[model samples]
Target: MSASLEKGIHALKEQVDSTVAAFFSSCVHCGMCADACLFYTETGEPERMPINKVEPLRRIWKSEYTLLGRIGKLFGLTKKVDDKLLTEWETLVYDSCTLCGRCSMVCPVGNDIALMIRKTREGMAVAGHAPEGLIGATTRAITIGSPMGVKLPALQAQIRHVEESTGKTIPVDVEGAEYMLLLSSMEIMNFPEFIEAVSKIFDRAGVSWTISTEAFEATNSGIQIGVSDLAAELVQRIVDAAEKLKVKTVISPECGHAYMAIRWEGPNLVGKPFSFKVRHILEVLNELREQGKLEISSRETQKLTYHDPCQISRRGGVINEPRSLLDMVADNFVEMPDTGKMNWCCGAGGGVSSNERADEIRLKVFQRKKEQLDAIKPDAIVSACSNCRLNLEDALEEYNMDIPLLSLTEMLADHLAD
Candidate 1:
């Protein structure tokens, strides 16, 4: 019932569905996934390979789930997974890998390596192998309604400040609002300007948007920590709040993993399709632009480049929305070397930013991003995800780079027509 090695192995056995079986069976051992992974590419460690990271889970599946595995186990040919093996693998799973899905993108056999890693973390957590920081964050998310312990009063204070500064009212829990906005804790505590920017933009566009005091937090630490039960609980709050408010759509904030968790994973985690649709904020802004509701008075003449947050552009299928918005406002916008789906991760995704233990390795692997930035050498970097912005800013400071970070929504709001 409680977390233990037996429970972790049992959980691993349960995760071995047909897709996982096929993935493990179809691996060609070609090492293509290695080159695609930033961890492996950075350290050249064979153990950091995405496929290798899930080997413990794979061994369980081989021995317990498959007929051939069962036969092999009969002869004691299968390698047993133990605490020692898991202890050795904790660094590979938590510290090195960011679950960026680049390996999945380049898998020659179409294996969803990233998803497998997420599933593998379920077992890891059960075995008590998850990073201490992620465990604390998940605990806070369940107990305090936010990973960062941001409560409604904090949100209300921010809301009051934005209302006072902008001279606009921010609707909360308004029944039948056209769109419901969900924000990440990072947006609330670190980037309160994001709330103000969205408020001004929606007010100028004459849009009906309300914030939900009940389910305002968007980032799901449960998903990051790879626990479905906790993830579903988080998703249920959003579903309950959205259905109760009768909002037509819920707009995921400019945070990358938040968009992926709320927009893509929330429905499945909650075990049913949501009553309302979920959309990334960029998608809604683009819709408003197409509808001629969002108008810009002037363009920015700065030489800037867009940093595609892995979840926002690659995982969320929002590649063009931010680019279109940027093209409208930025006169000299340039693309990074791999600007779209193949763009490099900010190196702090998949809960790495929350885990203080990953600080050094995260900055070390950030060399790939550093190389990309050095090549373009833009005036500033613009991105949607607040998490990515924080990571990028940290890494920039680590490297002593002078480039600044900008948010797409904030930029669009700045150029709004009077």
Candidate 2:
């Protein structure tokens, strides 16, 4: 009843709409996706190919939906979806693939292989083939309102610290603010300086924004675990808060998947568009700069490069906003090789970081990002996503590399006009 081959096949059948069918039909087997994938490229494993990860879904769609597949199924010639097949694909789909969409970009036939992977995860999760770490995180997210189990009181303590540090009172539940800010649990726990930095910058820019005690945790483990029901429940908390507080806009903090969850997938999962506009915090900062509200006192002297979070840049189209903000405060900014929309993933996205079993392979696959960093050899690395920053720091320490990881917002705050 919990996770069976019959349930997985049914989920796969339901997921294979016209679009998935078209992608399966159009895939020319060029194998370009293999090269574009970090796991495949780093390990030289054929099973890690983006197209191959969703083979079960493709085979199910073919046999059940397509004419030739129906004949094959009638003759018992089509590949069957079984426990063994699902067992073999679990690691490839959950641990190796971050759903970064780089393969989608590189597809010669314009196949959205990454989307298929995301869809394939739904079946995997229902089949009880999802990673245990992700399952625990999803449970925490739905039951405790945060994947990390961060409670409102924890955020309250952080707010008090920021308020005392910045001499600016951080607002909470103040009706009719111009913007509502959402922070990832990581920011609350590891990088409280983010809240302090945001408070100072917003004070300087004369912006009115408040943190939501109702839904402060922006990271959606449900999305990472590929469960829409749980994802929608997590998103609705923010919607309820935004509406209750009557905020004009909701600013997604510097978490890649968090931004993607609320800004891109929130409405779709909830079956309606948001009443207030959702902007990545970088986008909001850039808008402030465009309005001539953001003034910088000086520029960074140390040479630096950006590690673009794949969701914010490639998937969300917030490419120029971060660079534009960086230009205002960083004097010696340089591009990492294959930076921007085509940048490499941190290998810990899409709930991989939460999955303890993925630790070894995650670090191994990070060679792709390590190569990108080696090519640039920048003095410092700046990134918008806290998850990417944390992963980069870990990998840097692992390689004994000397580099400082800086948050784009924190860096900007340091150079604020006095």
RMSD of 1: 1.3
Question: Candidate 2, which segments miss by more than 4 Å at Cα?
Answer: 1-3
- Candidate 2 residue-wise lDDT, 374-401, digit = tens: 8878999999999988988998889888
Residue 8 of model 2 has an lDDT of: 75
Candidate 1, residues 326-414: lDDT per residue as tens digits? Answer: 88789999998977989988889999999999998899889889999999899999999999899999999999999999999998988
lDDT for 245 (candidate 1): 95
Against the hidden reference, what TM-scores do the models get? 0.98, 0.98
| Candidate 1, poorest ten consecutive residues by summed lDDT | 1-10
Residue 360, candidate 1: C-alpha displacement in angstroms: 0.5
TM-score between candidate 1 and the true structure:
0.98
